[model samples]
Target: MAIPGAVGASIVDYTTGFPVATTGAAPNNDHEAAAAGTADVVQAATSRSLYVSAVPHDLLEDLIITTAGGYHLLRPVQTDFDSRLVLYVWLDRAQGNLAVARLRMQKLADELIAT
Candidate 1:
């Protein structure tokens, strides 16, 4: 994975605020809570985007949050299964490359949708 120092990854359903699947280490070792929190982050970002005239788009591609220790990437999955789904990836700031991680995440999302 190009997402260096990845701590965890998960597929979450924002509509229901639940994790569909998860892998790796999640915050507090709780994937379910992490997924739910990720859904909230996605919802807030999407809602804010609607009010911004700069980029008027119905679809939310991704949301990135950088902390002192790591980076969080929230990618909404455009799948036949559910549009409300999102892919969440956590990476260490020291090792992860944001640009590469974004591309890799997109690829992961595409593969997920295809399956």
Candidate 2:
């Protein structure tokens, strides 16, 4: 998100749970590292749940999923065929809204940002 007071934001695919895009302090910080680590943790620990964990987010695919402190949102998108994908986002708990952020990600994903 490009909102003011935003600390950091990232798009992760829960299917392969990893960071796709990150805006803010990820370059120097371990934000991306933590994201990738969490994804692996989810995959190894909760693979049976509705939460589909992914590999490194940069590897790529059709899912857009997100994970933030106090929030984990998954927005699935549809293509012309039987394919399906989700949009993922990560935001800080104190500064982000689970509902509005999900909506925004849904809008972005609808525009084919999931790919």
Candidate 3:
């Protein structure tokens, strides 16, 4: 929750829809449901060919879902072993800087995979 406007954050195992860690308030006060939703969204995006990059070998990096209340940012944690994790953060649209939050999430995701 160090990031401005961050209402909730979670490190989810997309493959299993499991939340490894979570902090702050969940969307409906349920972290498990939020993690499952995160996994579903990521799965939908990755499964659809429309989201595929035109550039050969390019992969999906992140996703941003905008709601009236906040912005849902999802960053896939890429690792040398298995890249099945996603960092999800809910940011209040009025107070959050999307660009900065995205950058910070990218760094955090990298650090997560490093450890």
Candidate 4:
């Protein structure tokens, strides 16, 4: 929750649709459901051709879903060994800067994979 306006955060395994770790209040106070939902969204995003980049061989990096009250950010964790993890964050729109939060998440995601 160090990111500004972040209310909740989780590291989810998209391959298994499971939460590896979580913090703060989850949507509906259920972290498992949240993780599964996140996995579904990420899966849809990565699979749909509409979301693909024009550049050849391009891959999905992140996804942002905005609601009236908050923003849900999803960053795929790319590792040399595997690319099945995602970092998810829930940020209050009123208190969050989308660009900044995005950058922070990118950095955190990089650090996560570095180790």
For each candidate in the order shown, give its overall lDDT on alpha carbons.
0.85, 0.51, 0.90, 0.90
Q: How big is the positional error of residue 24 in model 3, measured in Å on the Cα after superposition?
A: 1.0
Clashing pairs in 1: none
Number of residue pairs clashing in candidate 2, backbone atoms closer than 3 angstroms, sequence gap of 3 or more or interchain: 12
Query: What ranking emerges by TM-score with the best candidate at the front?
Result: 4, 3, 1, 2
What is the RMSD of candidate 1? Answer: 2.0
Model 4 over residues 1-115: C-alpha lDDT tens digits? Answer: 6699999999999977899989997889999999999999988877675576567888888899999999999999888885599999999989999999999999999987777
Task: Please say which candidate is ahead in lDDT: 1 or 2.
Answer: 1
Cα error, residue 91 of model 4, in Å, equals 0.1
Against the hidden reference, what TM-scores do the models get? 0.87, 0.46, 0.92, 0.92
Clashes of each: 0, 12, 0, 0
Model 2 ranges off by over 4 Å: 2-6, 12-20, 26-28, 41-46, 50-88, 112-115
- Across 1-115, the per-residue lDDT of candidate 1 in tens digits comes to 5467788899999877799889999988999999889988877777667633465555667889999999999998886654688999999899888998999999999988687
What is the C-alpha lDDT profile of model 2 across 2-82, one tens digit per residue?
432245555555455567666665424765674665466445444554433354343222233344443444444455775
What's every prediction's RMSD, in angstroms?
Answer: 2.0, 8.0, 1.3, 1.4
Q: What pairs collide in candidate 3?
A: none
Steric clash pairs (candidate 4): none
Over the stretch 1-115, how does candidate 3's per-residue lDDT look in tens digits? Answer: 5688899999999988999999998899999999999999999988774676567787888999999889999999887886588999999999999999999898888888677
